[model samples]
Target: MNIKNRLTKLEQIIRPQQTPLVMIKFEDDWSPEQQQQIDAAEAQGRMILKVVFVGGKQDDNA
Candidate 1:
């Protein structure tokens, strides 16, 4: 299933104590609906976001 579908499915299950967290990595921006879903998940503190730049150079500043 796609990310949206997976998130939607996850939404179907309400588990705050034993909730599943999802880490999403994407190079491009998601649609409004997708963002809403992500925001909702984040409000529940069950999602992590990672932005990947395809072919873009990364600097080690740490």
Candidate 2:
């Protein structure tokens, strides 16, 4: 109701979150091994974040 109370609530609710922007560049020199590594990382991320694949489906084999 008061400014001080609102500021306190905001401070409690507005904690910083670390968001990772994971990416892989598929170049002409890319290999299956690199893809495998990316897949493993993405699989781990799926457990931590509710990742959704809009362009293509996630590798079930990962």
Candidate 3:
């Protein structure tokens, strides 16, 4: 509500937290070895982010 309170709240919101390792994967099938790597990352508290193919239906499988 006040200036001080607003700044405090903003600071709290933007405060740095525990940064998790992000694993970005493209839109495709993963081999057995790759899947194991993903599983290992999850076990170590890493975050896995997947991306989907948005070009076309036919191209998605290609």
Candidate 4:
């Protein structure tokens, strides 16, 4: 399913005060801007994110 549809379904299922932890698989490494956005969100305590890349670029501590 597409991200928007999945998110809509999730919104319907989750209750107030509940935050869902979502894991998305990407075809390639994310861009610097994307990482920056995620970092900013984390710094603000808005969300918790951990990215695990596989193969040669794998980063367990990211």
Evaluate model 2: give its TM-score.
0.29
Per-residue lDDT tens digits of candidate 3, residues 1-62? 89999988888789744455444456367667768877887887666665545555576556
Candidate ranking (lDDT, best to worst): 3, 1, 4, 2
Best by lDDT: 3
lDDT of 4 by residue, 1-62 (tens): 99999988887688334353333436576567666766766675555555666779678899
- The runs of at least 3 residues in candidate 4 whose Cα sits more than 4 Å from the true structure, single-residue gaps closed, are 1-27, 48-62
- TM-score computed on alpha carbons, candidate 4: 0.33
> What clash count goes with each model?
0, 0, 0, 0
- The most accurate candidate by TM-score is 3
lDDT of 1 by residue, 1-62 (tens): 88999887787786435355444546367767667777888887774554555676688895
Residue pairs with clashing backbones, model 3: none
Give the 10-residue window scoring lowest on summed lDDT in candidate 3: 16-25
Tens digit per residue, CA lDDT, model 2, 1-62:
99999988897689543355344445544368765655776665532232334468789999
For residue 26, model 4's alpha carbon misses the true position, in angstroms, by: 5.3
Q: TM-scores of all models?
A: 0.37, 0.29, 0.39, 0.33
Better of 1 and 3 by TM-score: 3
